[model samples]
Target: MPVKIRLQRHGKKGKPFYWIVAADVRAKRDGRYLEKLGVYNPNTNPATIELNLDGAVDWLQNGAQPTDTARAILSYKGAMYKNHLIGGIRKGALTQEQADEKFNAWVAQKEGQVQGKVQSLAEAQAAAEAKAFEAEKAVNEARIAANAPVVEDAVEDAGETPASEEE
Candidate 1:
């Protein structure tokens, strides 16, 4: 049977999520699968992928064809790179240790990049919130000042006050 790697659509119609799976080529998009490889969540600022690296590489080595979207998601998550490294190891151009080292380095760099993006986004949000708070405070202070009550001095009756003697 021809095996294919593809995404099975789930979640709401407008907000979709998917399961990455290994299934018969003829199976329905959301039908039964041989094995689930991962999940993809596209709703995030940066798309999120949770994949089983070893299983993916194994399937690739076994000649399971990946659909276009699945291929892109795998590439984004470095599964393709890992497969290439495995191929290099098989070809004797590189040692397994070397391949592992490269993969680890790449993972570390990717993690750093992702973390940096998240930090920057958080910082921007915080700055915006602070600015809004300050603007609101200023407006409130202005409103209070504008609506301040006026105080007037009371006048005494002319008959009640003692008159000064004329020289």
Candidate 2:
């Protein structure tokens, strides 16, 4: 029985959520599955993934092939790297402690990159808003200046018209 790791569609139209599952390779795209391993939500700013790491590793070792998108998700979460490290451990190329240390360092670096991106986005949005406010303020000042002389002229004209009629 060939098993596959894939996403099962959920959520409403447009906004999508997915279940990562272990299913028979022959099953339909969103059909029945053997086990629900986790969930994925792409609507969030940074795509969200919830997974059972041990279960996922076990499935991969047992030859459960992943779909392209699922593979990317697994790669992002470091499942693929963990698998590689285990392989290295099995082959005596590296110790488990060394593999864990490398994995932790990689995860920390990835998280820092994500944080930097989020901060940059926030700063850009704030700058755009400040620029827009300054432009609006300038427009208001121009309009006020343009109307001031016209208001003064009207008042002076009204006074002269009454005095000329009296003379």
Candidate 3:
């Protein structure tokens, strides 16, 4: 039986969440999975993905094909790379320790890149909020200045001595 690694949609409309699963290719998109591998949540800024790396690599090595989106997700999470390393190990091109070391180094580098992106995005959002706040503050100060003369005129029209003059 042909097998596939694919996503199954689950969350509410407009806020989509997905489950990564291994299943028969003929199964319905969301039905009859052989294993629940992990999850993907695109609602968050960085588009969160939590995958079972070993499980995914196992499926790949066993001949389960991945859909395009699933392939991208697997690539991002390092399953594809891990599978490649395993293949290298099988072909005597790399020792297990060497393959493991390479995979670990790659994972570390990917994590650093993700962290850097998150930090940059956070900094940009903070700067935008600060700029908006300053503009709003300036507008409020200008409005107060514009209304001051009108307030004084109304006081005089009502024959009430302005508070400053009375004092």
| Model 1 error, position 55 (Å) | 0.6
Please name the candidate that would achieve the greatest TM-score relative to the true structure: 3
Q: Candidate 1: count the clashes.
A: 0
lDDT top scorer: 3
Report clash pairs, candidate 3. Answer: none
**For every model shown, what is its TM-score relative to the native structure?**
0.83, 0.84, 0.90
Q: Which of candidates 2 and 3 is the stronger one according to TM-score?
A: 3
On residues 130-156, what C-alpha lDDT tens digit does candidate 1 reach at each position?
999999999999887766532111123
TM-score of 1: 0.83
lDDT by residue (tens digit), candidate 2, 1-167: 99999999999999999999999988998998998889999998777899887788889988999999989988888888888899999999999899999999999998899899889888998999999999999999999999999999999999999999999
lDDT tens readout by residue for model 3, 1-167: 99999999999978889999999998999899999999999899899999999899999999999999999999999999999999999999999999999999999999999999999999999999999999999999999999998998987877755565787
Question: What local lDDT does model 3 show for residue 124?
Answer: 100
Off by over 4 Å in 1: 149-167
